[model samples]
Target: MKSLGVIVEYNPFHNGHKFHLEQSKITTGADVVIAVMSGQFLQRGEPALVSKWTRTKMALLNGIDIVVELPYAFATQKAEIFASGSISILSSLHCDTVCFGSEQGNIHDFERTLAIMDSKKEEYDLRVQSYSQEGYSFPKASSMAFTEITKNDRVLDLTQPNNILGYHYVKSIGEQNSPMKAFTIERTSAGYHDPDFNTTTIASATSIRRALFNHGGQIENVQQYVPEGTYQSLAHYQRQAGGFHRWEDYFPFLKYRILCSTPSELAEIYEVEEGLEHRLQQTMKESHSFDEFMTRLKTKRYTWTRLQRMCTHLLTNTKKEMMQRITSTKKSEYIRLLGMSKKGQSYLKQVKKDTDIPLLSKVTAMESNMLNMDIRATCTYAMKFPEPARSEWMGLEYSKPPIRYNEETNTFI
Candidate 1:
């Protein structure tokens, strides 16, 4: 069976996500879909409003075959590392094609950008450095350098979220010389960070989350977009408790972690470099909240989001050695199955024997050290919630419910 791969954070699956999945299948003509998704944390350096397991179930309920965890270290990282780890997993799974959403759906443009980046690395690097020296954030510096080099306003626009990630996806695949075909689906109307959702078209996940947090999960605005199972799960959580989860509640713990760790220790964490540890150390003493510390330390070279992610990596005890080791590996050694359909089950059976990586369907498969750390971190994170919710986190498994598929309809239920 042909398999298509997707790299995602399904934070909470929405209508746009559903459309992407459908388009991926139609575009790739694949029988199975595999996703390398974020865990409890996402690339944005914030805890997921809901657990990864919950999101995985939503994926299966929406339209996906298999789901695998990207792990905390890679999930909460910069674009390059995030792309590398996720692409590595897809390559290992022997995916025939990988599809992702892109603001610029033109593959030729992305390839051209990659070619320029490859040939002009030195010039581009120097230009970025010069721009940084003149007081520009890394994103802005790189954007400026790229625009100057390419002389294409369109290429410069690739600095946006979807385009940047899409570029990294293509770049990583090229750098690794992987056989997988890369494709991009044109994004719909919703801007990723847009927070207003009462629209005729689909709403962004950000808007949906905002509505869920403000009014409750039962909002009619989002009900049509999300799967019934997803709504049920979220609404269930809300009715039993006072409200849905929020990353802000965990901010104190994250701050505490930074405050307790010394500069010497912070220096060892992944992405902590060039005396960033010192800045963090000094800022932690005076800053009370995560946002405040990040704002205080944000400078020309470092963006606020970048600094926050670095702090998150430190809080999670992600080390450079781990980063190096994971990258050096040919591919991910294990697949932490999140959710799948009956057709997916048959596909898994066919591929399981030949799969280069181990297929994991249970929590025990998380290896001793990894399991311990993940469980402890999840527990600590859940502590910010009330009594029953805290207990719920403890029992939440890495795997999700298997979705049933109707062969005749060729659709997931």
Candidate 2:
């Protein structure tokens, strides 16, 4: 069975995501759709709006046949590392193609851009380093370098969020020498970072999240932008977990973590570089909330996303050495199954014989540095919840089986 792979957060699995899944299937002409989703923390350094299990159910209820957890090591990193891990998983699964929604929408442009970068690799690296030394954020430096090197409008635009990710996806595919073909569909209606509801049905996830958080966690506020399953999942998660996950929910704990840790200790955390430890320790004392802390911490050298990711690392006590050891290898050590439909089960059966990586359904007795990081991240994310819910959710890493979705009954078994 041919499979098409997608890298997703599905933070609430809105209407635009459903459209992407549909178009990916049609474009790839694959028999099954596999989504590699972030676990507790997303790429942008924020906690997921809901748990991975809840998001897995949302994917299964939508058109996705299989949902696999993107390990924390890769899920929280920058674009290049994120794309590398995602493409590696898809390649390991023997997916025929990987599809992404992008502003450019054309695959050739990405190919052209990659060729240009390859040709000007040394110069590009030099410029990026120079700009970084001058206090520009890495993404900005890279964008500026690309513009200077390429100077052609025909190549993919690295400034657009989706296009930047898409470019890295294509680059990873080439670097890994994977068999999977790459495809992109034009994102409809909403921009990736647009924080306002500009469309009736196809609003960005950012906008939907903003609405939900602003409107007292009311699912009805963003109901028009997401599917019925997503709406139900959000409502159910809110009721059961007491509230949707957000940075603000854990700000107090983060503040405590920073204040108690010594500068040297904070410096050991991943992404905490060049005296940022002292800044974090000093600013966290005066800031009462996550928003306030971020406002105080923001600088031209560090993007808000970068600082948030750094804070996430600090909150989880993820040391730089630990991340380096985990990410030393090019591919993930295992494929963690989160949920699957009947078709997905059949596909798994077919692929398991030749699969190179271990396909894990449960965490019991599993011992690996990468998997341990995922479990640790789960624990950190669960701590913000109250009472029984906190312990119950954290224990899920050990006890919860891969959710089996019954397509016929439209329910998880």
The candidate that wins on TM-score is 2
lDDT of 2 at 145: 86
Measured against the true structure, the TM-scores of the candidates, in listed sequence, are 0.87, 0.99
Could you report the Cα RMSD, in angstroms, for every candidate shown?
3.3, 0.9
Candidate 2 wrong stretches, greater than 4 Å: none
List residue ranges in candidate 1 displaced over 4 A: 152-156, 216-221, 240-242, 274-294, 328-330, 366-377, 386-392, 395-413
Query: Per-residue alpha-carbon lDDT of model 2 for 1-413, expressed as tens digits?
Result: 88999999998899999999898889889899999999999999999999999999999999899999999999999999999899999999999999999999899989988888898899999999999888899989998888987885468778899998999999999998998899999998999999999988999989999998898988898989999999988888888888888999889889889998889989999999989999998898888889999999999989999999998998888999989988877688899999999999999999988888899999865689899889999999998888887898899999999999999899889
Q: lDDT per model, in order?
A: 0.75, 0.91
lDDT of 1 by residue, 6-48 (tens): 9998768877888898998999999889889888777887777
